[model samples]
Target chain A: MYLEIKDLTVLYDRAMVLNGVSLTVGKGEFVSLVGPNGAGKTTLLRAIAGLVKWEKDTLKGTRAGRITLEGSVKFDGEEVTNLPAHEIVRRGLILCPERGRPFREMTVLDNLRAGAFGCKDKKVVKENLERVYHLFPRLKERENQISGTLSGGERFMLTIGRAMMSQPKLFMIDEPSVGLAPKVKEDLFARVKEIYEQGSTILMTEQDVSFAFDLAGRNYVISKGHLVGEGTAEDLLADESLRKTYLGL
Target chain B: MVEAILINGLVLGGMYAILAVGFALVFGVAKILNMAHTAFYMVGAFLILIMTIMLGFPSLPSIVLAIAIMGITGSVIYKLFLDRVKEHPVAVMIISVGVAILFQEVLLIGFGGHFRGIDPFVRGFVEIAGIRATYQQVIAIATSLVALVAIRLLLSKTRVGNAIRAVAEDREIANVMGIDVSRMCVITMGISAVLATVAGAVVAPIFMVHPLMWMHPLTIVLAAVVLGGLGSIKGSILGAFILGFAETAVVFLVPMGAFLRGAVGLSVMVVVLLLRPEGLFGVVFEEERL
Candidate 1:
């Protein structure tokens, strides 16, 4: 497995957000997690990115409930659980968090430059910038514009473009279609699908099940922080009973 | 005439501008109102006093030494105390007040509360619109203007400056951008320390250095930051002059000058704050609600 999350239990303050949740993703595979409101899909992604506060929680000390990434999360690997959010980005595991939270006052180009801050090689940075511009020409045009002035849909594109500047191995996006219009959401989904086809593994969470199923190869349904149902896209789309019961399809 | 008052006010106000800018930079970027920032100025004054008076060091070298010492001290404070206070803002404020008190006491114990003065950093005076200005004052004014310009350049041109602004605007987003947030914060504190020290050393000869000298600067710096708007460098400069000139004018014009100085300064800030709570610069800090 390229990435393996084995029985990961996450708690926010005193509330349990993920209870012994386990999942896996292969190299270059696009996986989408579909769930109802307050289902802990976002929490799971945040925990993986090391943004979730862990100091106040109590752990059960179960070996099965462990997050192990193959590349450097080996026994000798850096214990990223205690490291800050920036270190995770430096490791090429970038996350475009929910809410399209770009640096509001900074120009679009500055925001993109910030993404490449982890890379020391100037050549790599230049190449990355060029590639990001190629991927999203809109960003290239609006490079000097302040991020705060962008529309919701344009901000979404800039957010994805900013993440692309980091040159990550896997892209973890949360709720891309959250506040977008229907047609814009459709267009965004198409862009995300195109990104996946261009050779990057994706781990995304969404409340929009119909659109999520269209883009995702495999789907998992979560409820109140637990994985209740999971299957291939065809299996999930065909099964009416699973959708209504777990996902409210 | 008001011309003399305005020129003198601007000159002195520019120096205070430096002092308040240091305070604003740390507060804006880290959201920690370090009460001991004034103490760093005091330390700089004393360092220069000791170097030039006791050790017989030259003025320029003494200023450089004072800035370095203060910068190191500020970094140490950040590492030893301020880092722990980053989460609990109230605790940080309390601890900073405690640190300020500690610094004042240390100075009192060592220096025995005696007022000390050194010769001006530069010699001679020039008549500007019939107001005789000393070469030291001219040097102070020029140095301050140059420093402020340099700071503006650093903030707009350098990578570190952008990182600082990013952290100032939103720390979590800066973290996502792979900025070492803690490191940047420490740098900010250190730079503030250097700024405070330089301001102290430059003005120490003009205003006699005593154990209690920081009390006045501390009051004025805070008032300037609040009046200018929290987290704004430009606001600090504007506020510093407004307060500096207002106080000087009242003092020059009034009969009981010394007694009414504090009253005038406080009233100006109160009036400005009442009109604009976000500050004259229109900078607003989002208050986190529990």
Candidate 2:
């Protein structure tokens, strides 16, 4: 496995957001974690990306509730469980957070440029910008427009495009289809598919079960802080309990 | 008389714009209500006095050294104190207030409460539109415009500036993009300190320097920042100029207006706040503030 996890448990004060959950993803594999709202899928991704640890460190002395995280996350055979979020990103693990949180006041192009902040070489950055523009031509057209004014689907594209600018080895996308119209969702699905086909590893969490199943090579079913099942789409669908109870299929 | 009012207003507004921009940047980037900000201005003025008068260093080098020292002091303050308490807003503000008072008292003990003066970098006066203005005033205007334009370029045209803006806008998202948020905050503090110090150094000859001089600027700067909408750089500059002109206009038009200047400026703030609670350029959404 390129990315390995073991016994990852996260506690926000007394609430067990993720309880002794473990998972893995091999290089260049497309894996999806499908679960309903509050099922700990987001928590799992956040823990892996080091954001939960960041929250814990930042909220240490404040009245903000405490977060206790315990686990081992190894990316590319290196321990990343204790690394800061920026360090995790520097090592090529990136998260496109939910709602496509564009830097609302900045231009679309500036947002993309910000995404490429870590890369120092101007040539490489320019190439990445062109590549992103090629992938989503709409971004190129609206490059000067403020990102806050972008529509739901365009924001999602911008988020993904921004993530692409980072040259990630593993992309963790959280709920890309949420709050988007079906047509927009279809367009995003095609973009994600193109990204994966171009040889990128992806671990995605989705509420839309069929959407996840349609694109992901493998799947994990999570419910209330635990991974209930894991298999290929056909294997999980054939399991009557997982499909009906967890997948809501 | 009109030229005198216009020149004085421009000079005062330019100084206020420089001061408020620094204050606004610290607040925007670090979310710190840094009460110690104008204290840096006081320190800068005094530093020039000590170096030029006591140590016998040249005036220009003294000013440059003072600005540099304040920049480092600002960075160290953020790293040593502000960074730890940043998650707690009230704690940050209280600590900053404590810092400001500490600077004032230390200066009072070392130099006494009597007002002091420093020689201007450029001596003599220039006639601008039939009004005689000191060369120091011209320098202040030029420096303010130059500093603001440079800062604008830095924020808009450079990679580090983009990262700074990114951190200011959304810290978590910036962290996820591999931009070090703490480092950005520290750098912003340093920049803010430099700006305040420059404002102090340039205007030291025009205004008498004293340990208590920091208090008046703090009151007016807070008003300007609030009136222009907090955390918006352009708004702060705009707000500063408005108050500067308003106070200058009062001084020209009303009897005892010099004494009534601060009250008039703050009244503008109050009226503006009553009409638009967010100020002229303030964003309604907390997340959108910069």
- Return the top candidate by TM-score: 2
In candidate 2, what are the lDDT values of residues B33-148, reduced to their tens digit?
A: 99999999999889888998899998888889999999999999889989988988899989999999999999999999998887777889998667888888888889889988
Candidate 2's DockQ: 0.86
Clashing pairs in 1: none
Which DockQ values do the candidates obtain, in the order shown? 0.40, 0.86
Task: Give the total clashing residue pairs for model 2.
Answer: 0
lDDT of 2: 0.91
- Top-scoring candidate (lDDT): 2
Highest-scoring model, DockQ = 2
lDDT of 2 by residue, A132-167 (tens): 999999999999999999998999999999998988
Docking class of 2: high
